[model samples]
Target chain A: MSAPLHDLTLAEASAAIARRRLSPVEYLDALRARFEALEPRLNTTILPLWEAARAEAQKAARRIARSGPRSPLDGLPVGLKDIIDLAGHPTTCHSRHLLGNVKAADAAVVARLRAAGAVFPAKLATHEFAIGGPAFDLPFPPARNPWNTAHHPGGSSSGSGSAVAAGILPAALGTDTGGSVRHPASHCGIVGMKATYGLVSRRGVFPLAFTLDHVGPLTRDVASNALLLGAMAGHDPQDPGSVVRRAENYRRHLRKGLKGLSIGFVRHFHETDQPATEEVAAALEAAARLMAREGAKVKPVTLPSLTDFAAVNRVILTSEAASIHGRWLREAPEGYSALTRKRLLPGLFVRAEDYVQAQRRRRELVAAVEAAFAGVDLLLTASSMDPACRIDDAEAVEATYSRQARTPFNVTGHPALTLMCGLSKAEGLPLSLQLVGRYFDEATIYRAAAAYERAAPWAALRPAL
Target chain B: MNEDEAAARAPGLGEAWRARAEEVAEAAAQARMMAQGFRAPADETAEPMPAFAVPAPARAVR
Candidate 1:
């Protein structure tokens, strides 16, 4: 017997829809049934657009019957993090302050996805304003890891990770500012990419930090992630950060093997910098060995300490986030969750000289990374220091925030992809590897990640939920 | 600035908000220290990093 519709990857479902073997409506129904059964426990979505999505799926089905698929994303049911605006729909950002925040127009990325004929079934949950999260006091409960529902799924793209992993949807939109996309992808065991800073437009998405925020995709597989990124990419004049680079066929290099590729293993980032768990350390070593065995040249490349990157990132992130939330934080300080308030309020204390200094440090760090990339095509590092822990553990959550090596790229504006590498022996939760490429070079990053995914056994495993 | 002095000197900040800012004081200080390392020898002549500027739209034919 064939696998269930919900079990199929986004690419598989898109092909099935195009072949007429599975109608868009049928696929939506399968996902709806799965969502109904699992959503309560996972809390992945804040607003489930059931009837509207069914209507759209029916429209897509008719279009497929009359013509062919509009794009690779056609008829694929996907979720958007609540931070993205959908015209005539509310984007609550999982905060009480923005509960009435409805958009008059779709976000640039959402508009592109709509043009591609992708079906939007829900707005996934997120950390309140995509910064502070896993808190009990929020407009919606934080998303739980499907691997072990009690454990954290990482954030601020919490729901995007959980929804894709739970198979409620094959793919979803996520925004990464300081490893939000990769963190959940790491903890949830999926593929997430923070495309080059300007590759995807941020217009209409709620901003946490304009200079640091990135819109990306979370998918169960690298191929699907590539497909989603291709659809979402392009320059938007409205988004100041959007670049004018020509659109790339992200899937063009997916099948290219790792032979002749050079990989830089950033051991010190995890070992001496933040110090990953033995399981994570072993996973990193195993991943490097697999790449070397696959004909890729793997070498250790050293950069500045993780503390330097984290310090620079936090300074810029906190300062900018404070400026954005200044009004609400000052007028209605009670509107934000305690954690969000705590995390964001610190920016208020940052001196102007300090913000400038952080920017200067950021430039130096970017130069250091570029220098490292000169000798290697990609840099590999741990997505998180350890596996997912119980969501209720406050101390663990605080430590995990500073434990990730994913934020360095956010500071450098380089493209990064995180994919499952192994499962922790103790918790059986996913451990992830992050691949960093030069700015606007996601094609190469995806090439390396796809090669790694092909050789790794982790992608074959899925949550029982 | 020390935590107490920074809080007391803060503009229009409430006691609770001041306490919250104090929580990340060490992090702010670390970032500041890193920034100092980026200073060029002739720092006064260096240009400050510019904020992101919106791109101008293409002009339509008259």
Candidate 2:
């Protein structure tokens, strides 16, 4: 109890709880206090259930005392993006459209976490239906970066990333279709993993783009991310997209170090395709060097252009999203923010041939990415082409939004993770690097991320609240 | 639905709102055209991803 309970990572807190050094109630109280002090500035939570969470934590404390711990997530406070279903609570998707839409059952992932003894303290904010950008016209204000309140914390999982980075919670679930999870992690200086497509069930989660959408975890560090992912991953027969493989112990390989690992550093991604800011490019180089020092063999590799992957991702996303919202657009267009309406309207114009072509090209793109891994165990690239821009600067936000390497993985359905590499000198904001592994090979991503985290001090850095 | 019908669906909005929606539609149209035009090298016979599969009958529980 020497350190504030809110400051402990999920792993550390779970360990303390198992040993009776800290009770779940005490842990939840600390996080509740942190939430009260920070929520005013961050606007992360849309439906906080702290009292209910505290009651659940008390039960968890008693259960653990009677019999060790259910899992590493036992009694840990994990938040959910508002689009995810939690029985008896409204799954609003941070839009006025869903303000009255209450859920009658838990999302598949939520049921898994609840079974693992995790306590839900709040449902976090997200971009409207996970497609719109941060808009002032939304029912709730967009979550701000904890590193600097003036800057954006990346979305559509804005609240998940901001809350974890600000020490309000150790972990939160975020969905990524076009880099929603990794975008926030990149800007917030936290760990976000979009595991291979369909590795986590999406049955009760609202879809942005059915084929491209993925549920993921955003956490303060790599180890905790692995633990949370382990708890969340499993086959769900009810979910059509769910993979039918047994979930592996993602943390099993965390300590394996980077020795004998061959990493393909996709330099063209941040260098030639979509040029990153100078500081971001330099930090990526430093991260590669750190990995090399850890005994990883780093080599340059190439894939299709950033535009190619991004185009395929967008065509499919917009087309599918358009189809889903066509009725809503025609019936209640006034309910949507201008930004969401603007983004969704484009999909209506896309031809059937265009969507089909994009899907066909997607196979080729996925194969190209797989071929890039021929001589490598993993791929390294930039998560965000630049550090986060100011939240209020719509021009800057629009300009830098598509300038990233993350959409490629979503297009290819690879397990990709982004974690803090360094802090930007000029703005004092976090800069991040991404590691990608073969499909369903998230363990290796965790291995390399943990190694880099141990060597670089960025993982220990916290935003001054 | 066609683009014209899609636009007409949002009737009775403010002039600025309609203008903004028009701009968005125009931009989106251009982007879609560009995406359609950029032909990445792929086999002519490559099938679209997420290819449909027939669901198997559920197995009887023991």
| Local accuracy of candidate 1 as per-residue lDDT tens digits, A1-465 | 199888899988988887889988888899999999999899999999978989988888888899988887777788999999998889999999989988999999999999999889999999999998888998789999999999999998999999999999999999998999999999999999998887899999999988888999999999899889999999899888888867778888988878888889999999999999999999999999999998899999999888878877787888898889987876677798888877876676678877876776677777788789788888999889999989999899988878999989988888899999899887789999999887677888888889889998888899977
* lDDT at position A292, candidate 1: 94
Recovered share of real interface contacts in candidate 2: 0.21
> Looking at the true structure's interface, with contacts defined as alpha carbon pairs within 8 Å between chains A and B, what fraction does model 1 recover?
0.15
Clashes of each: 0, 0
lDDT of 2 by residue, A203-299 (tens): 8999888888899999998999999999999889998888777777878888989998999999998999889999999999999998999999999
What TM-score do all the candidates reach, one by one? 0.93, 0.94
Positional deviation of residue A30's Cα in model 2 after best superposition, in angstroms? 0.3
Model 1, residue A39: what's the lDDT? 91
